[model samples]
Target: AQTVTQSQPEMSVQEAETVTLSCTYDTSENNYYLFWYKQPPSRQMILVIRQEAYKQQNATENRFSVNFQKAAKSFSLKISDSQLGDTAMYFCSEAGYRNSGNTPLVFGKGTRLSVIA
Candidate 1:
């Protein structure tokens, strides 16, 4: 079984500050993928960043990046230069079980991030 866990239920940051959201997962497969998704109030799923197991470099996009520790089974999201628009529910998910993509993403409960201006 592959399980992704985000221990923090909620987090906050002042405008322009930086915040890191924690995530951990349990998986037996050596080659897999991980993703961080942002869901704003509008309820749309936005891809923040994705890390491929084979890549030694962590994935990054604009202000969002991930600290992927494969051996530790930990993947964390780091947000720099946080803005009001960054407020949203972030979910960490694993993709690459034999039936992973065929089924819906098994998501962590989520971490609601609020960026205060």
Candidate 2:
């Protein structure tokens, strides 16, 4: 079984500033994928970044980056130069293989991020 946890329920950052959202997971599988997704007010799930359990390097996408600590089972997202568009609900998820097929992603409750001007 795999589970994702986001300790912060809500967070706010000033515009053009930086913010980091924390996530931790517990999975028995040796190989899995960790992800950070952003859902705006329009309710679209957007992939922020993804990290593979086997990869030693962290994943980055534009202004978004992840600090992946495999041993600690921690994956945190850092949003740089935060903008109004960054305000959304962020979810941490994990996916593992099952019987040669990818299992459905298990997601955290989500953290609401507000980029205040």
Candidate 3:
């Protein structure tokens, strides 16, 4: 069994500031995957970043990045130069068993991020 946990229930960041959300997971499979998804007001889940357990370097997007510590099973998301549009619910997820290519994500409750202008 695998479970994802987001310690922060909500967070706020002023425009152009930086914010980081905490996340952790428990899993027995070595080939599992971790992800951060953003849910906007439109109710769509957008992939923010992803880290493969096999990779030592964390994954990064344009303004979004992750601090994935495989040893401690921690995967956190960092939003640099946050904007108002970044206000949304962020969810951490984990999936996969072994050698499988794709699987459905098991997500945490979420962290509602509010970006004030």
Best by lDDT: 2
Q: Mind sharing the TM-score for model 2?
A: 0.96
lDDT-superior candidate, 1 or 3:
3
Candidate 2 overall Cα lDDT vs. reference?
A: 0.94
Candidate 3 stretches with Cα past 4 Å from truth are: 97-101
Q: Which runs of model 2 end up more than 4 angstroms from their true locations?
A: none
Question: In model 1, where do residues sit more than 4 Å from their true spots?
Answer: 97-104
Native-to-model Cα distance after best TM-score fit, residue 32 in candidate 3, in Å: 1.4
Model 1, 1-117: lDDT tens per residue? 788899999999999999999999987666688999999999999988988888999999998999999889999999999999999999999877455444346688899999999
| lDDT for position 16 in model 3 | 99
The stretch of ten residues in a row with the least summed lDDT in candidate 3 is: 96-105
Tell me how far the alpha carbon of residue 86 in candidate 3 is from the true structure, in angstroms, after superposition.
Answer: 0.5
Question: Is candidate 2 or 3 superior in lDDT?
Answer: 2
Q: Write the per-residue lDDT of candidate 2 for residues 1-117, one digit (tens) a residue.
A: 788999999999999999999999999887789999999999989988889889999999999999999889999999999999999999999999767899889999999999999
Among these predicted structures, which one has the highest TM-score? 2
Q: Candidate 2, 85: how far from true, in Å? A: 0.1
Lowest lDDT 10-mer window, candidate 1?
97-106
